[model samples]
Target chain A: MVVYGVALLAACYLIGVIAGDALGALIGVQANVGGVGIAMLLLLLVSNSTSIKLQLGEATASGITFWSAMYIPIVIAMAAKQNVVAAVSSGWMAVVAGTLAVLVSFALIPVLSRLGRGAPKV
Target chain B: MALDTLFDSLVELLARNGLITAFLFVGLVLALSNWLSKVVTRGQVHGSAVAIAAGLVLAYFGGVATGGSKGLADVGLFAGVGLLGGAMFRDFAIVATAYGADLGALRQAGWVGALSVVIGVVLSFVVGAAVAVAFGFTDPIAVTTIGAGAATYIVGPVTGTALGASSDVVALSVAAGLTKSILVMIGTPLVAKRIGLDNAHSALIYGGLMGTTSGVAAGLAATDPKLVPYGAMTATFYTGVGCLLGPSVLYFLVAAIL
Candidate 1:
């Protein structure tokens, strides 16, 4: 049953990759565009759709949940493998650019929050 | 001599099955990180963040110890780390995170939440690109990659890879993203009350504007556990939006300017 989840994921990933490649071609770029993100959106749609959910059953649904929780560990592995020393040594640009982005983004929060105040509560 | 032979064989066996070894090794790291988060930081920092920081440190030390470029994977026993952390698994894991999101809940956040996601991605990209230019990075590819990194760590590398930017630039983008994640994680609780981040509505906007799911989720957990899902929901969409725009539209915009 868990394997079914992986199968579904694989299907989504392949389709996403193809779609991304096509999109890239359409836009005149030579690489995949948003394949992972597209795959995620597809998964979200399939997982939420009543028809698909009914076919997937409870066991397969749990398989999806199992992989979802795996995100944290996988991300940790990804982070651990990055060459931080090299990145830091290359220049101060990375640090400066990142810090400024966060600071500016943080500053904009209040302004965005205020803009949303006019909308009625959902 | 017999014991030494057995130890050699064991190491070789593990090395041959590298993926399994990586799983075991990362499991230990995760366990340790979770413990540290719970016992040492009192959950002030999420376990994943701590694990990532630890992984970075270990990678630095691994590179130093081995005098190699591949980091820990250069060591005989940890070779599987390379494959486990490769782009294939990374993308797979990222895509899997969307499994449990509720569509109805997304609609509840309304149009403002949607606007925030777009604003968050573009704002971060513009600021990041500006800084990249300020630092004399005239290459549009590099500038776009770095700007994408400002959107989120995931977006940065994705953009960089798509644009065929140099590895060094990609690494820089990732570092930039990690910097933002840590800042958002630590800064959220402190700024919560001041920014009126007390309810689902504000949390959704906060998630969108921040756009780092881990940071926003952990920050919201610290602020209010109930708000985590709402913040994380929009933040997830933020990554999607960033990825879609970074390589295509955003890259063209930067290329036009430069």
Candidate 2:
């Protein structure tokens, strides 16, 4: 199962990257199929965990949605790169942006949750 | 001129082996994502219709990685096909609770962990996009690094839910934050130099870099066990310092290059 999962991940990545470009070209926006897949996987694992139990279907759907939304950062990052077109064409910038987005979001979670609590009364 | 050449070279390389490059890039991204999810789901792990969707991504990248291209029809077919992993790992707590497992009371804790991953992704992406837009450029790569730093440093422990050592997790987050700073300090300057940006202009690249790292550090320190609120105050302080250091060095390097 583990090996299968790993294989599946690898395969998905390749398709996401290659097809993303062709798709991106047609749409006039850089496509990050790999980014979306990873995001989906992340959500998939999170949702499935006996620990979270967000419900399989809901978690799966949300996972995709959240990951797709996460792509915004990659778009922004490429735009910020020295050559946006080349960056998108190469897709390295997207990889870097997507990785960083995941990391930053993961880190801030605790702090945000704490802050989400109403301030303690004096 | 040098930047242009490098960019041109990258473009050429990509164009020549677009399929291969795409596969490599996607493979790494998914692999990294898997590792990260392990940290979150602890091996618990995607979609239906979504299933074919994932398979299409798989088939396309796989074909490209293997030195070929999938047909448009195949790609479309794969996108619609979906897979279901049977069991949902996230609901472990609830399942246990129903069975009256000793840990049944901890379901909310599990939910916390799940929420951390979901919310973390959303917040960082939005913030990152805003930051990029403010800079008048949107490079997905930069936003990713900053967002990951934020997620790892800030959200890691909150998402931990006692599945593991919070202290250890916090320490790991610290390591990650430091890594972010170092990567930026080094990466920005190299990129700046490559692009022929004058030394004076490099600072702009480093600004958000620091903000991200510090945010994570603060989250880590704030959640650690050793520091009472007062001690954590110190952690918070350190986080600020770390945050400040990342961009500061980036700016200095940019300035030097320009």
Candidate 3:
């Protein structure tokens, strides 16, 4: 039963990758398009549409939920890893921009916070 | 199965491929960070915050060890990390998270929420471009690439590749975006109280201001999971806006200035 759930995810992922790549090709970029987003959307559509028609068992449903929740931490870690690598080899300017963005956001917080308080309903 | 059990199975598969190894590394990092957060920060800090820091440190070592473009890919066992963490999954995560967002909540954030996304993207671009100039990057492509990267990691590379900027410049932009994401993740919880980042409404504004979806989502998850969708909803648009502006209006402005 859970096998059916994972199969759904795997199919979505495959379609997502293809769709993303096609979009990238259309846009003239050489990378994968919104594969993850496409996959998630596909999953959402399939799960929602199939719920009424198909009797997805508890084990199957839980499998889908488990993978969905895991998406964030896993992706972020991978992205962070790539980012760290790019920053290290890209020379000082890249490092500077990265470092400076963090510093600037920190400094901007107080100013933005005050500006955001125009209508504090709470 | 429970999360602990999931991690148990995941860690054993680390050597299987890039995706599995990537998952293993992330799980290990989260576990370690959660432990640190509880023991050291007394739970003041979020586990994702610590995990990102640990991830970056390991990434650095991976790059050093393999001398490869992809940090973990340089190492044999971690090579699949390149695919696991690539744009496809990144965009999918964003899309999936955004789908969970409710459109009705947009009213709570109001016009201020809308304005923040625009202001945040432009402001970040300006800051990034200024840094590029200060560092003696006189070329428009380099400046624009870096500036776009400041907007969001996704926007940065997209703009760079579109404008024919060198790989190095594009890479820098991604780094710039990543740094912002990491900072947002770690800083949100600490500043949530002071900035009124508690409600669904305020979370939208916070997301608009931050703009990086992953950063805002992780940060909001740390601050309050209920607000993640709200913040991420607007944050998604921030990326779209950044993509629109990065290669066109912003690039022209930087070119003129340079």
Runs with alpha carbons beyond 4 Å of true place in candidate 2:
A1-93, A108-122, B1-60, B63-122, B134-258
Greater TM-score among 1 and 2 belongs to 1
Every candidate's DockQ is 0.44, 0.06, 0.28
Off-target runs (Cα >4 Å) in candidate 1 are A109-122, B1-5, B66-70, B108-118, B129-258
lDDT tens digits by residue: candidate 2, A2-115: 343333333444443355345435533322222322323333444356764533344344433332332212211111111112212323333344346434533443344343
lDDT of 1 by residue, B122-234 (tens): 99999889989998999999999999998888899889998999988898888778677756755777678788888767777888888876567446644665565467656
Score candidate 3 by TM-score against the native.
0.71
Superposed model 3: Cα runs more than 4 Å off: A1-64, A88-92, A103-122, B1-14, B17-25, B80-84, B90-103, B110-114, B164-168, B221-223
Error of 3 at B253 (Å): 2.4
TM for candidate 1 is 0.73
Worst window of 10 by summed lDDT in candidate 2 chain B: B81-90
Cα lDDT of candidate 1 equals: 0.76
Error of 3 at B199 (Å): 3.1
**Of models 1 and 2, which has the larger lDDT?**
1
Q: Please write out the lDDT profile of model 3 over residues B87-165, one tens digit for every residue.
A: 4565444444433344445554557777877888888898899998898889999999999898788889989988999
Rank ordering of all candidates by DockQ, starting from the highest: 1, 3, 2
DockQ of 2: 0.06
